[model samples]
Target: MRLVVDLNRCQGYAQCAFLAPDVFAMHGEEGLLYTPEADEAQREKLAQAAAACPVQAILVDAVDPPAEAVSGER
Candidate 1:
């Protein structure tokens, strides 16, 4: 999956870091550093991070079909 964090909108709240340490980190400057492509195993954590961001800066995109079908699909 692909994720993008809007640095301009981020307030360095660290919620993303707490929720998905593997994909999100707090830099020494108090800004955030994150991976755009997260492993499939980290999806849940990443989603949590996205939801936890107070500024709503985190954006997640799936690169491929999920292992499990989505609820709306057959």
Candidate 2:
């Protein structure tokens, strides 16, 4: 599984961190910390985390690889 948090859209609500502590966390003040790649077992937690985002900044399992990466051109 993979996830992406749009920092610009994030409001530091800590919803994701609270819901998915293993994958998302707060890094002092408003700074957010998280792991992009996650274990498949975390899918339910990740989904809950994404849905809990007040700002909807978390995108779970929707990470699209770069065109080159998908095409195996690089």
Candidate 3:
């Protein structure tokens, strides 16, 4: 999965960080930082983080399947 946070829309509420510390974090006082690419195991936590964003700044997108997986190759 991929995570995208709009800095312009973010208000540094720290909700995302609270919900998903492994994927999101607050830098100092006015900044935010997060992982762009997340493991499949973190999908649920990532979703919770996105939903917890009061400013609706977080965007989560499914990563495209690998070429081998799509082609059914070994």
Candidate 4:
């Protein structure tokens, strides 16, 4: 899945960085930086980061389960 942040709405709060360091970080001048594509393991953390944004700048694409993983053998 992909993570998108609306810089226009961001206020450099860095909450995303704290919540999902693997996906989000602060640039030299406090500008937010992040990986657009994240592994499935990081999805929940990314969601938390998005919700934690004070200005609600973070956005996440809805993730679809992989075919084999959704077979539900377990």
Q: Which candidate's TM-score is highest? A: 2
Deviation of model 2 at 39, angstroms = 0.6
* TM-score on alpha carbons, each prediction: 0.80, 0.82, 0.81, 0.80
lDDT of 2: 0.87
Clashes of each: 0, 0, 0, 0
Give the Å error, residue 31, model 4.
0.8
Sort by TM-score, best first: what order?
2, 3, 1, 4
**Residue 59 of candidate 1: its Cα lDDT?**
86
lDDT of 2 by residue, 1-74 (tens): 87889999998999988888999999999899999998888888999999989988888756544455566555
lDDT of each: 0.88, 0.87, 0.88, 0.86
lDDT of 3 by residue, 1-74 (tens): 87789999999999999999999988999799999998989989989989888999998885564455566556
Stretches of candidate 2 off by over 4 Å are 63-74
lDDT of 1 by residue, 1-74 (tens): 88898899999999999889999999986878898888989989998999889999998984575767658766
lDDT score at residue 66, model 4, on the 0-100 scale: 51
lDDT of 4 by residue, 1-74 (tens): 77788999888989999999999989977788899999989988988998888999877876563566656586
What candidate 3 gets wrong by more than 4 Å, as runs, is 62-74
TM-score of structure candidate 3: 0.81
- What lDDT score goes with residue 25 in model 4? 86
Q: Considering TM-score, which of the candidate structures 1 and 2 is the better prediction for this target?
A: 2
